[model samples]
Target: MLEKTGVPTPEQVKRAAPTEDRLKKGPVAVVECFQSIPCDPCQYACNQGAIKEFVDINDVPIIDHEECNGCGICISQCPGLAIFVIDATYSEDKGLVKVPHEYTPLPEKGEVVTGLDMAGNEACDAEVVKVQSAKSLDRTPVVWLAVPHDCLMKVRGFRRKGGAE
Candidate 1:
């Protein structure tokens, strides 16, 4: 289904998601990479060593949720845009999701944007909390959004209001 639609099935997403207990612990990286491509930047970007070393160059990443502090350093390093950091404990009603943004005119902090699901559908309204575009990120900017707690997993991307894509 993923090869046909470019969107991973729900079951695949479940397998990539961290456990409920791990989510409650705080922010953690969620590697949604399912394909076995020759990629390992996420593992190398993790200073905490949370992303396990690849046994093979094409092996999918294995994240040690306990070791990840959810700093989101790996978010931008992932060329495939498969890495994200979720902070469920950010608030009782909201959660923080850090996603990669490669488009021009990035969303500004405090701006309200339309959160999107895996299939690029509208999921919810999210507030931009932070935008990290350090030179160290290699030009991939990471946008932090605060969305409803219920949409923590659903909101994977966002569309800036009246902004060019």
Candidate 2:
């Protein structure tokens, strides 16, 4: 399915996902990079040394969940927009997913947005918790979204309210 379509399969996603025990700990980086292309920015972006050093540039990133603090510093560094920070322990009913955004008319903080899944389909309604657009992040800005706990993994991207699908 991944070869036929750009979207990854559930099994592929599971390979990259941290363990349930890890998720309950706190926020952590989730690298959804299924392909082994030339990419290493995510490793360099991780200050905690969680992302293992790549032996070959084409190797897929291997994250050390124990070392990752989920600072989200690597979110904007990914050119493929594959890296995300998920905090399943945010609240009893809610979780936070930090995704990279490069679109115009960025969703404002405290605004409600239509959360999109990996297939770019509407998953649920998410609230914009924060927007980090510092110049250091290059041109890509990171958007922090507060979504239902069940939608934590489902919601990877979002569309502004009444915005284009």
Candidate 3:
């Protein structure tokens, strides 16, 4: 969850979508994170000083979206299994969740998968629409998928068909 100094919080993200309508005509959250490891590449990745010190590297890096302009610098710089971008207004039918997936035998873009919540429970269905990877993004392979609006904050991970649990 992003913690922009003047943006929103986990609670605000829950209260009412505090995100700009990117699909329409505004900015959105670009989180390329997944794990809670001891790192801060995302913090250093941000030029607007959006992602700041985690206080503890083990803690998830927070993004100040107000200060952030949806620049995806942190998305490709993160080393842990954490980070993602959530456009709450991606679509009226569904919200797009771009998660930093690094599992081997990666799924193709347009593939469908089960979006798992924090508890690893299947909360909703997500389909990969875009796959961003390069020598720079490392081997993590940030996968961009679309999910339900209500499931955005709940989703934490995903598993493909016949994939590991």
Alpha-carbon lDDT, every model: 0.90, 0.91, 0.66
Candidate 1 lDDT, 52-88, residue by residue in tens: 9889988989998888888888898888999999999
Q: lDDT per residue, candidate 2, 1-78, as tens digits?
A: 988877889998888888999999999999999888987888899899999999999999999999999999999989
Question: Better model by TM-score, 1 or 3?
Answer: 1
lDDT computed for candidate 2: 0.91
Question: Candidate 1 vs candidate 2: which has greater TM-score?
Answer: 2
Minimum summed lDDT over a 10-residue window in model 2 is located at 156-165
Residue lDDT tens for model 3, 1-165: 353342334654444333444334434454534346676667777788877766886876666666766545566566645455666666777877767777777778888989987557788888888888878777767777788877877776789987663
lDDT of 1 at 165: 47
Name the regions of candidate 2 deviating beyond 4 angstroms.
none
For each candidate, give its TM-score against the true structure. Answer: 0.96, 0.97, 0.71
Candidate of highest TM-score: 2
CA lDDT, candidate 1, residue 92: 83
Which of candidates 2 and 3 is the stronger one according to lDDT? 2
